[model samples]
Target: MPANLPAEAKAKWLRVMEARTPQEKLEALKDFLSSVPKHKGTAKLRAQIRHKIAVLRREIEERKRKRGKRGPKFFIRKSGMAQAVLVGLTNSGKSTLLKYLTNANPSIAERPFETKLPIPGMLQYGDLSIQLVEAPALIEGASKGAMWGLQVLTLAKNADVIILVIDLSYDPLYQLKVIVSELSDAGILLSPKKFEVRVERRRGCGITILGLDPMECKKLGNLLNDLGISDVIVKVSGEASAEDVVNAILGYQHKPALVLATKYDVSRDNFNKLEGACRELRLKAYPFSPQIPRENLKRELCRAIMKALNLILVYVKTPGSTPIPVTLNEGSIVLDLIEKVLGNRILGEVKYVKVWSNRFKFNPQKLGLKSPLGDGDLVEIAI
Candidate 1:
């Protein structure tokens, strides 16, 4: 009901109101609370902002309390492979990218938010396979736990590399800003120091994984700088092939990744413009059309995945009727673990698995597993 609010304050208020998630709304409220004038005419608006902040704060506290009782969550086991997360707005070709790269075959549709859960796939490079996790849409208010925003944040924080997929048809800069803002709100620090990596010699070869093309080299340099790599000199030697550049980037302790532009066939001009933009930003850009033959696209994606995440794949086989208890990285949700174990197997008779961790101490009497077998422990499986 307050009148005569400043334009800036009005904008902030509007953002708070339209915010998709509680965290975003909370941040907008804080801005409004600080920026809006508390004069006689604007008293009501000021009070409204304050009220919203209080409500958000309460909700956040409640969530924290609930999460606290649950204790620390499970994170993916860091196996020295660069973990890469494919992130973008809903339906921005992220799933398609995953499918092409790792043959993950996540549900791909023209509709938004088709990928509600995080899908992890591995791109095998000889003996190595990097883990690629496709995250859900990171809309505004993602920080304060809006629509699995917290889950997205958890996945990103655990990742060593992030592939931000943007629709070239839209304003690339705008999309970048949105992603940055969300990351910042989630308390992810972007510092130049994190970007610095010590370049090492491999097999007496001066490994430079930067693209050989002039435009690619320039774009790679810019992207490295944006990611906080300041001191390294990235030179594009026409002699170096795209594979060489990709290897160099992956081999570097601090690897800078390429921004893959999907739907390249839509418009050559748009692709060129995006490439120009990438060059301006000092980041490498690759044009890809998943609409092409699936096999070719899959190969391209596999190459990209290998470059993005320095992964080595090692397959372990377990032979037993008993369920092999896989100790996933701490902070892994039970749901994610279940998916990993089953892998497209329909959830039929086995509804769930009981996780025995330090945090979750099971009382033998409570679960009726108190009686010790001749061996270690006996668990009664319930369908």
Candidate 2:
């Protein structure tokens, strides 16, 4: 018979997983195993926890051995763009969202966990293109590091922004709590006060939306107090027909957000219910039908996305080099890279090239010279 486990043991078990180093994790595991009373009720759980710890210890040893023989296990090269991750439960329209927003064509299925590997997509908003990465679904006990939960959490930690998608058809609040707990368990530390505001452009007008912004921090708490919302914010737009709203939010600066109600064609009342819920949460909700013709909606959404992101596309040319592709936001400096290459001492020696009438002229250099310049290239001015 297993013993009844105390609350302290469970808390200790959680803390053990939070250990940073392998040695610490081992120590935590040992402590937890020792602290847990062995009785009929808890014996089975203790065995399970013990098995997990043993597996973790073995994996750690293997990693250490490999590190001694080699260097690091994996190398992630940083691309020159801020990375945003789209996360949600399986079939929560994450893949669909990625497809509509970026060039990435991940498998969109009705099944769960369609995206096992991290899928990266380039989101072209106006002239700037941001990288959007979609991670796998997070399951229950994810906070406890169950079934690759730790891996997912690690990915989330590295992200500049985390876009958590949830199905409005289900309990949105419940889903939010699950994600928050998972993040907390993974040590991501998502504070409501730390939430930033994102401004999006919709229908040729700029719309400012509150995210986890400080101004809205209390709003979430208030909602919780009223039992109106759960731990997570659900946007009905994922199921809605308004792709523009979705694009606007994604391309929005400061990570602005709105709720999208999808599958409105199924039932009018469903859309209304979602809208009402959004109103209660003080969020904007739009009804959308996914079955609508693609051409009818894509352009508007793309435009909105581009506008919201404040993206700019610039062309660059370097001597004896193929045109390198680069996208930058408006008002960003191209001289930073040039300075790095030319060194600070020689900064004044190079002239800044100005773009006039959609044409850039090298200072004091004659125009109309036949040079192959492709789109999205950065050119340096050499006097």
Candidate 3:
């Protein structure tokens, strides 16, 4: 659009406009960016061209990646109420914790790296079963592809909650910092906070958005224009940052995580330091030891992880049978429970539902489909 644009640059821009495939558009964009003159007046345009090239390149790369084979060897199927992965440095009693927490029988050893691969175990807590996995130890420079670090973290990232196990006998704070740093380097966010930005690229349609104010849209438009991303649907939920926009475009997973301090009986001084560090990092830490009653510790650990995951335990009761526990996301409603308990076919057959809660003295109370269900609520459905 600039009058001072060179003829060659304009010609390449025309080719980009005419290009159909992402690869072709990418090539034309690169050529245009290369041919364009670098001046203060054209700085903004140049940036836009570079951004477009990057976006196109990413699309092409993603397509190629999707063409590759997917396998079960690297990925574990999710099961149970929630999947929690145990991560820690070597000899942090991860295997011991696994054996105690769940039925897993991973070999416990004084040596490091005893558990070479991921071993999954099911932990039962208050009629709720959670799938817990013991992943390989994480060390420094893992993001650089050191010692199967990426593979281990990849599995951890897919989990519903990352149970970070740190040995209180050592420098627990520094170890926690290392794990957090490496995870950050791998583009895995451990915050419970969710980004308020969403992006969906559509072909032939220009940018359409919701949840973002006018100024936010204007700024986002400029960035998308730079990336040559014209056709997309972007929704922003909360106050998002520029980095969040780029991450949304790139597609990264933000997982909720909590700290599990092992060997509480090791050193009170170190345990105190670890607690202080966890507070500073805004992370919740739960201490556990083999000295405590096994059942109590298991229940405590499960309860802590459940709270961190923000889930609710719902009990479904039938007229002639015992109550069954059902896990649902926090803030779930009666309709959601119906869908979970009974299939869609059965959902239509339901006439009404009765709910009971602690507030209601566990007495049967009629609730509409839209009624919100709380943790430990009981529901009885009649068709």
Q: lDDT winner among the candidates?
A: 3
Tell me the whole-model lDDT of each prediction, alpha carbons only: 0.55, 0.52, 0.77
- The order by descending TM-score is 3, 2, 1
RMSD to true structure for each model, in Å: 19.4, 14.5, 6.1
Highest TM-score: give the candidate number: 3
- Kindly give the stretch of ten consecutive residues in candidate 2 with the minimal lDDT sum: 223-232
lDDT (tens digit, per residue) of candidate 2 on 159-212: 655666666666655665677566654445332121232322233221223334
Q: Across residues 1-383, which tens digit of lDDT does each residue of candidate 1 receive? A: 31555556645644554567778768877876787666776665556446557646865775676577765433445542457777677766888888886757899998878987778887654444567788888887776667777667667766777677776666665665676567655545332112222233233232244435667555554443222223333444445443344334432122344566666666445767767766764455676666677666545655555444433221212232554333233233434344455553544554434333333356332122222121112222334
Candidate 2 Cα outliers beyond 4 Å, as residue runs: 1-80, 101-105, 124-128, 189-337, 340-346, 352-382
| Candidate 3 residue lDDT tens string, 1-383 | 33256657755665775677778878877888888778775788787566556545554654465357463244578999889999899989889989988998999998888888888999987687889899889889776667767677778878998988999888898899889888876667777655566556566667787776787777777665554456678887886655567556644567778888888877656777887888876678878788878888777777877787888899997666688899888889999998898867887788778888986865789999889999888898888
lDDT value for candidate 3?
A: 0.77
Better of 1 and 2 by lDDT: 1
When sorted by lDDT, best at the front, the candidate numbers are 3, 1, 2
Stretches of model 3 off by over 4 angstroms after superposition: 1-74, 200-234
Better of 2 and 3 by TM-score: 3
